[model samples]
Target: MRSYLSVWRLPSAPVLLVAGFAGRLPSAMVPLALLLMVQQRTGSYAVAGLAAATYGLAMAGMAPVLGRLADRRTPRPVLLAQAAGYPLLLALLVAAVLGGAPTAVVLAASAAAGAATPLVSGVVRALWSRVDPEVRGTAFALDATATELVFVAGPTLVAALTVLAGPAWALGVSGVLAVAGALGVATSAAMRRWVPVPDGPRTSPFATVLTPGLPRVLLSGAALMLGFGALEVAVPAFAEAAGAPGASGLLLALWALGSVAGGLWFGARVVSVSLPRQYRWLLLGVTIGLAPLTAASSPWVLGALLFLGGTAIAPTLTVQNSLVGSIAPAHATTEAFTWLSTMATGASAVGAALGGALIEGPAGVTGSLLLAVAGAAVAVLVTLVPGRRPTRGRAPEPVAA
Candidate 1:
């Protein structure tokens, strides 16, 4: 606790922390908000689901492009542009939903809003590199923990807003919050001071700031998120099937709580471990924790298991972020982080759809849970792929671009 407090006392750390939290709050709210808005407007969950998937896909597709831009220039311009554009796009989406606009139009607006989603998580994660070396790991751990909190609270906020005002208001409020947070960080002194270093001539067209080990990092991230996506859908299905639909949220919250606990504990450790090795061990824990979800017959059992499983979430992410910082070229930190975000989003989307289908089909919740386990297993496999030794104290120099 003292160590975390000390980190916050550093210049601009508090500002970045608060703004990043606020900026990412929208991510938790937007999907549920969109679901509620579209479902209320169109009377069709199928359409609403499609709209939500479209939004996720669009965000997944555009994050890399936007991240690359941030790498080429600086995060400020990219973030500022998003800050100005995203809310407008969200408003347009709301108008289309309420006005009985064509499904295609609503989908288009959703994609547009997604494309303009502020690059908050990436920017905040990238800032850890600028912190003192001794505290960098702690900073990353705190950041990951905070993100877990965002996921936990974001849904609660959406539910509250929907009950108090309506779904449209919930969506609108998220847009406003996202805008404020993104703009706040973009204009901060820390962000401005951290400018991009230019990439020298590179042979590979696909190469950005991503270094050799990053592909494995991204694949691991995807697998982790893919398992999470399955867990997200499967938990609800389990709750409903067990005749305790209300337990779904509680179970999920328990999972987030576990993640928070894990992150704090992981961060506070005073040990010196390499990122890749820590990541490998975290994935093992995650797989072990999640493997039993298939056997859970009631919400009580699932909740306990989920909380245990969730303990791996923050630790895994914290290690993943640390690993990225270790290996990413100095010039492309933001882009590298964005790629991680993109792969997670894309994989989660796919996992959600697959989980839902499996649950609806003969395979049932057990199948979905098994798939989640498989995803985590795949993550472990990816982590084992031979790569350069994990960066320990500084960003690796770019390979002869």
Candidate 2:
């Protein structure tokens, strides 16, 4: 607790934490907001789904490019550009949706809005890496926990605003938060003065984002997210099937609560093991926790198991961030983190789609849980593959700044 408090005492950590939360709030809000806006205007869930998918695809495709821009120059200009453009683009989307514009036009505006979103995740994680090493693990833990909170809060906010004002207003609020958060971060002393340093002679500019050990890290992250998505869908399906559909939200909340507790406890501890070893163990823990869910016949039992499984969430993410710090070239840290986000997002989408199908198939929710376990197993396999390990006995390249 004192260690986390010490982190907040740093000059800009509190501000950055708030900015990160507000900036990322849209990540949880935007797709739903887009879906609501499109559905209200068009009265077609199909079109709304298409529009939302386009928005996600746009964001996923552009994140790496935007991260590269932030890396090559500075996050200031990148954030400034995004801050100025995103709200306008979102406003355009709102107008297009409300004004009965063509579906194509509305879709284009949504894509533009997605592309204009600030690179908050990459910038924030990269910033943490630049801070004190002693607290970096805790920082990552806090970040992961806060992100889970955002997932919980953002949807509630959107639902309330949508019911009160309308989906357009809800979307506008997302734009407002994004603009405010991006400006706060962009103008901060940490962002204004920070620079990425070169990784010396052997590092190629084009190859920076693809550092040797990073691909496996990214793959494992994707696999983990895949498992998460499956669990998400399975919980809802299981709850609805058990005739307690309303319990699904509470179950997911409990899951997040467990993750929060795990993050706090894990962050407060001192570690002696290597990050890779810790990650593998955490992966095993997550998988072991998930195994019991298959036997759960009631929502209450499933909820308890979900909470147990969720306990591994933040610890795994903390280790993953540490691994990225060690593996990514200094100059392209932001891009590398962005790639992680992109892979996870894409994989989660795939997992959700697959899980939805599997839950309706012959095996039902059990199959979905099995698939989630499979994803964790794949993550563990990726880590254990001998070829994935980086070479030892070589000194790490120094930052040139």
> Residues 1-401, candidate 2, lDDT per residue (tens digit)?
99888778777788788999999999889999899989987899989988988888789889988888787787888999999999999998888888999989988998998888889888888888777777778888888888888888888889899999988888889998998889888888778668556434544544654567887888888998898888889998999999999898889888888888888889888899988899989988888877888899899998888888888888888889888877776777788788888899889988888898999899899999898999988998888876545532232232211
Clashes of 2: 0
Can you tell me which runs of candidate 1 are displaced by over 4 Å? 388-401
Compared with the true structure, what per-residue lDDT tens digits does model 1 show for residues 1-401? Answer: 88787778777788788899999999889989999999988899999999988898888789878887887788898899999999999999999999999999999999999889999999888887667777888898899999999989999999999999999999989988999899888877687677567665556745753467888898888998898898899998999999999888999999999999999998888766767788899999999999988888789989999888888889889889988877877777887888888899889988988998999999999999999999999999998888765343234332200
lDDT of 1 at 397: 33
TM-score of 2: 0.94
Q: What's every prediction's RMSD, in angstroms?
A: 3.1, 2.8
Best prediction by lDDT:
1
Q: What is the C-alpha lDDT of each candidate?
A: 0.86, 0.84
Worst 10 residues of 2 by lDDT: 392-401
